[model samples]
Target: MSGTLALASAIAEMDRDALESLVRRRRPQAPAGVLDPIGLAAELLRPDSILRALSPLDRDALAVLLGLAEEPRAGLARDTDTRTAERVSALLALGLLGVEDARPVALPEVTNALRHALMTAGHRPDDLSTPPPSRSGDNASAPPAAPPSADSWVTAALTAVGQTAECLRVLRDRPARLNRSGSVAVASVRGMAESIGIEADHAAQALAAADRAGLVASGGSSLVVSERAEEWTESDHIARWLDLAATTLATIPAPLRAGLVREEPLAAIAAGLPERFPLLSEAESTAARRFVVAAEYLGLSSHGRLSSVAELLHSGERAAAERLVRDLLPPAAPGVYVQPDLSVIVPGPLAPADEIDLAALTVPEHIGVASTRRVTEASIAEAFSRGITPHQARAAFARVSLTGIPQPLDYLIGSLAERVGNIQVSEHHGDDGRTRIVVGSSELADTLTVDRALQHLQLHRVDPTTLCSRLRADHVLAALADARYHASSPRARASAKAATESTAPPRAQDAHDDLPEALSDLVERVFLAARSEPGTSNFTRRLELAIRDRVPVRVTAEARGQQHTFLLLPVSLSGGRLRATDQAAGVERTLPVNLITAVESA
Candidate 1:
């Protein structure tokens, strides 16, 4: 019978919670042999350990030990069977169990040894137990009687710090002391383990051993270095880590080094090297220069005109590189310079001398310009109130020489033009030949669309025109119109129409009459109000509301040379149809009013 088997049997007889509680209650304040069974097991199994001196026990002996250990009343009764007694006695002989004043108690040394063996075997310890540092030494410099291997001290240092300096720091700053007398806390250990690439259970076991060594103390809520163990933490862990980092940097390929070092300071760069690097002795200036060079290579710093320099280096154009160096010298602000290989120079204060060959510098493919233009949208209702006609608005737009179309401005202008029959798009080409498009409409819609588009593109670092080129203008116009129409009320639309008509030329009335009922219905639903009064007004409102609720209407067919489209059903109608002969198209295809699914007043 062996003590471990005896303990296992004892534990098996109790419910899980009871067993756990019992272990917890019996845990010692300091690392003790009994505090870590798994760790003990590992130590016992080591090649030359004391545990190797004992012969292996049978299962019956283990079961007997477990039964004795778990029982509240420890001793086997006098009447107990001979078989159980024999097993119990073997466990006692093995030092796994002790009879204290005739009561059975687990020997602390035995438990510790068990824990060590279990850990070595990859079995989870019932408790967290940091293994002692693989090696230890006194501050004394006298050589060992048996000289140590060159790598021994280094290995010892690494083990003392754990797998990585990062891990060491985490262990050093643990918030709660782990109770290693029971199963490891996977969550608590995992939180720190993942940062250093070790498995959670392995880390927990290691941490448990550290705890036993007094390097870490359990402060109920967190782990901290014990006052007594503070001296053990004096080693230059950070310096060692820095050395490791530098080595890692040196091994990176030159081309990739720039990106790797960029944005990191010299000290930061030195913190990621492997353990063997010589960090403590490196010169600060040298480190800084190396860091700076790496950063410049990585595009982390502005080392002259970055693109130009990169290009010169990649192209292997030495003459051009020299010329760029003279042109971009000093690499300071408020200087017109060029990037060339290893050097950056500025020729003079403002302009380079004739000797400085500008021709050697390569021009980047794309350039960006920032510009803005004004647009206006006056509500038809307001214009009518002011006795202003659509024609007058058009004339006003033309007088301003804002009639030419700008590519990016098309969507904005087209959207406004769709609402009022008389809107205009004007582009004025400046002396620089850059065109500006101005749209005339009710000020509100124009402002909103422009503001929204500009804001959206701000994050993309592109101009409105560039952004628009990537999008389908017709789609944008449709979306804008739908939004505008849906937002306006029936009363608002009616008011706008009345105002526009008041100042509109007589011909404008005929134009209104010519509009397709479906289009008109959309306008009314979007901008006009349904009169509470009966008859014509009520019928029109009802029809508009019904259409708005049913059909998924959208601006489908756009005007020639325009980005904006007119309102139409998303899908063509199939069965029943209504026709409007008086409209501009002279034919309005009616859809089943009931089949209409969605309507957008906008």
Candidate 2:
């Protein structure tokens, strides 16, 4: 039997409940009218609809479809194990597979469409070498493995979030330009890694995670921290981790994730893909490796084995996953150790507010296993330059310190407060649009002019009372501030401009497609036409086949209660009309599909 006929017969045997269940499973919007077995089968067999449905199926199901395509009737055995039976049933519901002679068979149209899609994607299954067997066995009867310690997972999660935040800060200060392909340059990633004090590979993974999480976005030709980053920064650690983990998982293509089971290492899954399965492109292979790295960073896996958190996330048990992570997170330390040596040692994860404040106030000396930050006179002066007052700085440290503020740190803040405003910068619209700068004394002005760190300011001394810079007032102010010379601007500090215009953060494109919706309207139209005239659906299918195959067909039509038959060379099918050349009359006839009673091959 032909594919269409075989599928139609299989559908015809289903009861209303079974038919409705199948229809709903495909997730098509409800049709305007009910669909009979034949109409549904014809709709499912349309080339475009079949291709769309096949693209997202898991690996085993697609493989089965491919196998059955070569031997439609005898490919899949009637006696399948429980797992295979389940896959067959899912394929049956989608109409990609149909039962024939009490055994499941692939729909020829679906199989052909899938093959074409594979070819378009540059996947040549025929030429693929046999896939290597996984070092971790794939047998069903294997005992489940224990999950890794939650402590290590939580630690890694915290590090990922922290490093990603650091990367965003660096990009925000100096946005990186993208290449023509809209990807960050390797040199730029390396630069960011150096800035964040991390390995280049870790930085690359963090940036990838940041992009997927919507914390960073493309700004035409460069990458900028997106507005959503502020919201993310405000969220607690658990929420932040969830955002990155979920977003990264969603971006991985369905094919790469197929056959991935809980507790299975992603590396193993990538390695075990059947050579006959669709081959990943070089870029795709790189992205696959990046995803594994991201998964590890997000605490979804450890030593290449999937964690319990990952399993919960994959199954869509997000609430449970959140709770699991919450429980697993290490307790936040109420305070940090403030040393007289001007170093702050975080014995554990500090409270969010304290961590954020301290990060702004001090310089990070170490990260990862043992987090530490240093408080220097220069650091304190820089903090003062950013509008942080002496009192505020003192309060922030005291609020989060186990040992009360040390004398040296207290003296540093007090001394900075006394001298902060001594050096002043103001906008000047004189000789050549220069910014006017006044220091505490000529000695200081002379010191500042020749200071190697402030050389970029190009301070041109005008007299003992004043100096000038060609750059804007804000530029000179920031340069002096970074040099640990507490400088203030009498005029309002100019808001910094972004390299590119700001835009809404990009949304993740991971939602499952409404697979059945592609066929819904077509089915509705065909269903309605069939209702007004019996066998209209079958006739339409035959007409489409003739048109596509460039074949002549015998068409029977009724007009004014009279029936006429004509041999037609089908030309086109569009807008519910079939246009064909009447072979006998040697003229074109455009027939409304509803008027056609039957169609058959000549």
Candidate 3:
């Protein structure tokens, strides 16, 4: 057998990922059907096998080559233009074109791909009178561009990042841990969103971005903040926003992203959308808008839409993000506003340290454009408890307040600090003669009755403020302080290693891996979820077929509390419980058979 025939045989046996990878390589190789041009050409005329590798321009070039298939030249420039010439040369290099009668001719592979594409779109042999499906290019979104004069978008994205991270913390750090899955219970998502005071849809996007960014990841039983979370929290707000935005843009359809990075506008790109994607025109338009949302928030597009800078980020131009921020957020002299209502306002984004310091001493009322903080004596004392001295805390407020710290705030800070540590906890012997927890307050114990922890012990009256729990004096004091009794514990024991042992902090990751792999996994996941007509009779038969064949199927089931569009390959359907493998998570899940409301093709 000819070597070309052997190579073609090997190519035909490869899996989808392997085959696509090989074809996608920048080094275009001789296609499989080189030896028997007639046979190979016939196969190429079939659609799915090769058109997946061709862009619209490549397809158009292939169509031109087809029109001249009967001509005999080694190669054809088509036109003198560089792009046209390059396209023709690419066809030759990819083995899509070969010499026939000494004229450049379409290989069987190209013809087959074109035919397959046409027939897949319902074309008929007798209907060559109309346009071929391969030549129809109305579906793609146009190349995207940003409008001018828009507000900075990075700021909005940063706000989203903050909100997302905090929401993840609420979910993962809760006493009752939430379940973690590729398709987590939407009810849980809604509950967490409610806890964080955001819409479920918004929270879902944030969670997706956070998961993609590697700050939060599945930990088998529950979602947990990964080690990356530490570095994420430490990174500058702008850096965090850029990271999330990169992950978001990475999710755009690859062809669209490719075109954008190559400097195509959305209108131009839009022309190729309808024919390529399953999405409708509105969805295509929304996707184009999606690419611009994060960009506009980053102030990369002052004009209000996607800009060249955003395309740069999508293309892995890391340095472009910094440049965009620097060019857009020019440094301005800091300014402050102090109001009669005892609030401090920063006219713009705060210096990093000042933002943290302010949070420790004030409650934010507003965030964008101008930041407003309402100050109270309790907040001032809270900062002091964190080792910020009264003088230092007052100075921080003064530095950020135009009036140099309001007189009422200053006096309140002093008064609170003076008696802050008065209520104390100590280890003492009760009448029973065992070491127990007791509050040592110079003030009357009647004020301690309001402590929630004390209420848990049913201690309405505080005679020596003793609690019945087995907790340490230090723990008791901290809990009381948290409840605003301002407790301290002088007699609490210290750890033996407290003086000698110094702990190390988390090391930062230089860069994260698994991004491309994870992105691919996500694509496969979406591909596996099927939309179905709601019901059980037909769904049961489909479920059985999938189970018997070991193929993945999506089950849209509504259980008592476990409602979801589930993607799973059934492992068993016994005991009125459907046991299946969740491909996205690579985990086993069991659902009550009765919950299998709908099953659909995947």
Model 2 CA lDDT for position 423: 77
Candidate 2 stretches greater than 4 Å from native: 1-63, 75-145, 274-285, 415-426, 430-433, 436-501, 512-536, 544-551, 556-565, 570-581, 585-597
- Per-residue alpha-carbon lDDT of model 3 for 183-289, expressed as tens digits? 55677678777755567776666666676676665444445556666576566566666777776666665445544533443444545454443222345456655
* Residue 586 in model 3: lDDT: 84
lDDT tens digits by residue: candidate 1, 111-203: 555445545644444222222222233223654233222222232223323333234345443443345653335676788766445566446
In order, candidate lDDTs are 0.34, 0.71, 0.52
Worst 10 residues of 2 by lDDT: 492-501
Highest lDDT: give the candidate number: 2
Query: For residues 219-335, could you state the per-residue lDDT of candidate 2 as single tens digits?
Result: 877888888887887777678888998887777655557656767667666665433245344455566666777788777788777788877888789999989888987667788
Candidate 3 lDDT at 419 equals: 50
Estimate TM-scores for all models: 0.17, 0.73, 0.52
By lDDT rank, best first, the candidates go 2, 3, 1
Worst 10 residues of 1 by lDDT: 362-371
Q: Give the Cα-based TM-score of candidate 2 against the true structure.
A: 0.73
